[model samples]
Target: MASSNVTSFSHSTFVLIGIPGLEAAHVWIAFPLCSIYIITLLGNATILFIIKTEPSLHAPMYIFLSILAVIDLLLSTSTMPKMLTLLWFDSTVISFNACLVQMFLIHSLSAIESTILLAMAFDRFVAICHPLRHASILTNPLTAKITLMAVIRGALFFVPLPLLIKRLPFCRKNILTHSYCVHQDVMKLACGDTTPNIVYGLMAILMVMGVDSLLIFLSYVLILRAVLKLASRERLKAFNTCVSHLCAVLIFYIPLIGLSVIHRFGNRLAPTAHIIMGNVYLFVPPVLNPIVYGAKTKQIRRRIVRIRTEQKGKITGIYKNKQMIKW
Candidate 1:
């Protein structure tokens, strides 16, 4: 199954037909994709801005949240622009190196985002389970170390993915099923035996996502046990602190799991459904995170509302002055 020209893989280009079997609908698909991208950018940016400027939000929880915002921004930007270009302008060709870079960024950023979620879950677990030691447990220095480790973990694990793909003989049709390049997605195009790639990729996922997911669940379980011991009112308040994080987690994982299951098992499913599911998990968290946080967290909501109110007041004041002007 070796490709005819192994060296050609280095110079080969791949075509990303936005959604297979739905080429005619690419123009219409642009609307929702663009909207999701716009909202993701605006929402994540606003969250980071507010977190950075609001002194009240300088705690460990908010610090982790800002890290999450950055991850969301990076993850969304890694593929959304190229995707929109493909969908709107019918620009489907991507050079091999460019595709490799995109694949690396998307995978690494995803790994980093997963680690951040685990960190956030840890933060909540500590705060709820051992309230008195929360500050000492999650210090700024420790948080910084966590962030650094997350970054390094993602980089170290995902660096090999691009290299692995680069070594493969991709002499097939060179058409990607989706708009982006992922290890599995790109591996499918290679003409050589892909057993090693598939094995390594699955192992990478198990190491990064599988372990992180297990730990996150363990954290929540401990948190639940702790919450149960609190007074009724305190229990509600404690759970309230977790609502936004919970929403963010669900938005990120539920669709993600669904998509993964469908991909692995639902070969006979409609292509449109497959495409939509793929896009949903990829696009939802970035768009919904800030909205969920702002709407659910009272302090964040108040700060965002105040900013809007101040802007409205300034606009109103300017309009009133225009009525008093002698033009």
Candidate 2:
């Protein structure tokens, strides 16, 4: 009788876990998150457009920036919309399959972004530290190949996570806290032992985020050493070129690390910290990347200005021609 009661309770708990929160906080959270999503989408889209249309921005650096923008846009889209809906309309329901899909996309895009940042670091190292070899080394074909490999690696790394989650026997307690369908949050609701899920999750963190960050660090170290060997003015110039990338890397990785730490060791603090860090991690890079790479880079800025100017001229020409036709 006790065993049957236990099983029944488990099933009931599972059904209730994902129901939307009732407080005003849900609406509050949803509004700001929705705003951020809009800003992130527009910012990243603009960056992609500017890079695509501008011939002067066709270097390896801008190519990598475009890739990063693409990754950010997808990443934001994967998690933010559902979160907004959940917050605003009290729709906390996600089907098991839908949750797994969301988790896969979130992880895949995050992994891809990390790898692209590493690639961007390599581009900087070559351009500043080895200017003569930059073109030869990062040829169009090679750049395309590298981008392809990054996407492939990201997908391969995260492929198992969703599979593992889907395989879990979710007897009950499916309520996911916070906002979106994160792996850890979803796993917390599993009725069966989640040892394998936890292990796989940790392994992914160790391999993808850990390894990619390490390689990026090494790339910077080599760049610094090479820059130091140059004349003082040249060294300063080389270092200056890295400032934006460095800022972007810090903005991206720091909050991610903080969120991970909070999720792992600080459960009590996870709710507030997770939401804050989650927003930062998701939206900051998308908003800042364009400013860092586009606003700060001379060539990119000039191209943006030129594009805007040409667009304005076309609009003006069309308006004038329409008026003349009317007259």
Candidate 3:
């Protein structure tokens, strides 16, 4: 009986509502999201291919880039598929278990991505501040260890969340206002007082994201100081290298912080605001990462062009050889 009641409540709350502005806004959101998704996949895949095929890009920076590409892929995958499904099918009825799983994956990936960015910052700091020690400090073993720790830490940090959600007794209202299963959005449906969930959520955000951001900021501060003391050319070069990454960080973090604030407080803005920001946070980095790196890093651009040219030449030569054989 209890299970039946919970199911009924969940079903009633999970009904889909088409956007307020209707077809125009729907088309606006869908078109850009689809375009961004395609570009992001192509860009990230190209970066991954370059890193794998070109030995020159096997350094710490590109290794981090490869990792970032993978994270971006996962991050986009976590939300976009369901979102696109909702847009296409106009169905938003996610089961409670499904919602919990989505929430877990989203938060876990978010934490992992933030931690990886901090690791990247530390990599930059080492490269700039102690150039001689760059190779030794960011060795393959160390990089693998850091990557492992990021995954493990992110998983462990968010493991309790789904567990807590499962244990909660659902109230009469189980409908999540937003399209997806955000932690706070789901917590709002609990029958009992949600003080514990709120506390845990805030603490997790503070400890995981807050601390990681602080460390990254400090690392960059030291890097800035180190850059100032260097030759003007080197200083400029360092700044250029960091600019793309800085832009990416801002685009990612700003919306996330905004989401946190809106969720914690009340949602004064339109519901579409939440949906738009969610899409932005998920899709922007994947789309921009390739463009940034390809534009900023001349070496990568050269290698990509070279790779394509070589492929074309090989195809031409094969055709010519076939013609000569036939003749």
Candidate 4:
């Protein structure tokens, strides 16, 4: 059995189903997927632009949010373009090397996003729990260090995944269930023993998601504890500071948990169900993060509106100049 499993596929390629059970609806699905890609790009871009241009948003919270917007942009770009091409053009065949690259970027950048969220949560905790020392605690150098930590943690934890998966012989199958590549999905196609891949993948998930989530939760718990001690109006005011971050956290982690559950326990179900959950996990956060922050945070919303108003004024001014020229 071991000898039979030793077949090589180093030069082989893989076919991604794009959306296994929804192949018939690829064109229809492209509408929403493309919309998501556009919105994620535009929204995150706006956030980054506003944060850069607006002096009021230079605080630690907004700076962290800008970092998150960058993460979302990268995370969405890593998978959406290929998925969109697969849906519209039926370009499903991917070189194994490209597939590995997609897997690494998607998983690693996503882990970084989660780490950033944890960092943001801690920022909120400090701002709320230790209001006076917010500046001293989350200093510019410290934020830079946190940024480095997030990148290093994500890059280091999953660095081995692609390497491990690359060594596996893909004699069993190369057709992936989802549009993009993932380690677990690819591991299922390997004919060789997959224990190391499975163990490492699970360990990464547990270490990254498990630890990040626990700390984020604890940060919120402490934040809530701090809020409770404040007078009622101040309590609401303090709690409001965290609402945007909380919404972003929920938007990201909930779908992640759903996808992980479906991946682990729903093997017996219809393949389409799994695919929908996987896409949902990928699509929702990037789409919603900007919206949530723009809606919940005043400075971001004001800047967005202020830019729009300025543009409108420019257009109106141009119209008046045209009228004067006509006269």
Candidate 5:
């Protein structure tokens, strides 16, 4: 029976443990998770809508932001709904193929987001470091090419992940740690050799995130060097432009680092800690990114306020017209 199980990858299924040792609290825990998902969807959608409709926002920075918004939408959507199902409906079963698909989406989207953030850093670097050539350097065609490259790079790098996992034989240890599938968690359950999966996954992460992070840091260092040459007032103004992106960088990387640390080094920690960190790593950025940009970005902030003001005026006009008709 065990040998048969080892041979049958097609018939294998995995069960997701939503939050280990907290099964009884799953329903109660779902309320906040659902709220976060809804907020992520709405917030990112609003960012995209504003950037799309507002002509003044048709620049390189906003363009990158819109791409980030789309990524956030896809990233959260990839994992949250299934997580909610596990929490609310107690539906824990996921097929091997489905699990692979989920893992691919989650990891690929993360790669893309990291690339986008790095691109945004470069955009800022060019803007601050070479203000005169900003427009020439980041033309529409170039921006489009950059966006396309980020997508293609992310997708192509992880294409091997699912294929590698597919080749692994499972020996019936098919339980997962999180609500959604991840390459690391799923790879652990396979009874076959996981050294290839481990080595490949690490290489992919280093190539995508590790390299991007180093470049982003280098870009900022150059940007700071350029900014320091300006007068104090000009330096302040230039630094202000990067505030939102800096906040975004912090929010994104902090949780991710925390989760990675917990996964690798904190095995003695409670499973709940691991689960909560994972959720925060996935959910917090989407929920907070829009809010950060909306508040710190002057153009987006003014547009949002103008929209609300116009909406209020229209509502008042309709109410007055109805009152007049009643009279």
Candidate 6:
């Protein structure tokens, strides 16, 4: 096995095919992808900025959101630049080490994002279910601990994946299906026995995503029970706080689960279908998370409106000054 593995090693570097079967349209696709990347960066940054400057928004929920914003920034940054490069400059060659690093960041950040969402759910649960003790329960130190745990859990779990891939020798199949590297995609290209990779990969997903999803569901179920007992008006008001989170959850998990299922079971689908789903999974959440939260949350919406109003007033005052000088 060792001799065969050594003899079959053919690729010292990996090539990322931006989108399989869409080589001709790479340039055209870059336009919208670039737009989305810009939106993701600006939106998440704005969220972080607002949450930081506004003391009124410094509660546990907003703190978790700010943490989430940071995660989204990292998550999108990991892939969008290289993807745009592949689309525009047509430079597809990536070193082995760089590919592993990208893979680690992408997968681990995703897992971290999932964990953050779970943390957000718990915040909601405390606020709505135990309104009296919300402040006491989700203290600053506890929140920090939760955030740290999420980061450490995500980082440690996926750290071994790239190592596992490093042991396998590629046999001339260096082209990746998407713009970024993923464990499953990279592992499939190896010529060596991948049972360990497959088993560990499944175990990691089940432990992180699987357990998180289940706990989030359980949290919401309890929240629903608590919410139903409130007066009609109070019930609406209470549930409104959860809307942004639910939207965030759906946008993040639906695409993620869809991508995974398609990869495992939808082998009959076109490469384009797989590629499109991959883009949606990676791109849509960052672009939409800030928008959803800013629009849906009353405080964020008010702050944004006030900022716009203040800026408009300043611009008008400047125009009046210019007119006075002309007169």
Candidate 6: residue pairs that collide: none
Query: Which RMSD does model 6 reach against the true structure?
Result: 3.7
Model 4 quality (TM-score)? 0.95
* Better candidate number, 1 or 6, judged by TM-score: 6
- For candidate 5, the per-residue lDDT at 155 reads 97
Q: Estimate the TM-score of every prediction.
A: 0.94, 0.87, 0.89, 0.95, 0.95, 0.95
TM-score for model 2? 0.87
* Whole-model lDDT values for every prediction: 0.84, 0.77, 0.78, 0.88, 0.89, 0.90
lDDT of 3 by residue, 1-327 (tens): 112334557532443333545634654576677778888888999989988989888887788878888988887777777767667666656777777788898888889888888888888889888889999889999999999999999999888888887777875655565556777777777787778788888889888899999998999899899999989988898887787677767766888887776665645788767666665666787788888888778778998899889999999999999999999
Q: Write the per-residue lDDT of candidate 2 for residues 136-180, one digit (tens) a residue.
A: 999999889989998999899888987887777776535555566
Off by over 4 Å in 5: 1-10
Pairs of residues clashing in candidate 1: none
Write model 5 residue lDDT over 122-190, tens digit each, in one string: 999999998999999999999999999999999999989999999988775566778888888888878
Per-prediction tally of clashes: 0, 6, 0, 0, 0, 0
Which of the two, 5 or 6, has more lDDT?
Answer: 6
Q: Candidate 6 residues 1-327, lDDT tens each?
A: 012332343456677777766678989999999999999999999899899989999998999899889988998898899989888998787788988999999889989989999999999999999999999999999999999999999999999999999998777456777778899989989889999999999999999999999999999999999999999999999999999999999998999899999989988998888889999999999999999999998889898998899999999999999999999
Query: Any idea what lDDT model 6 has?
Result: 0.90
Give me the runs in candidate 4 sitting further than 4 Å from their true place: 1-10
Candidate 2: deviation at residue 70, Å? Answer: 0.8
List the RMSD of every prediction in angstroms.
3.4, 4.3, 3.8, 3.6, 3.0, 3.7
lDDT (Cα, tens digit) per residue for candidate 1, span 89-144: 88888898999999898888878888888999999999999889999999999999
Which ten residues in a row are the worst by lDDT in model 5? 1-10
Judge candidate 2 against the unseen true structure and give its global Cα lDDT, from 0 to 1: 0.77
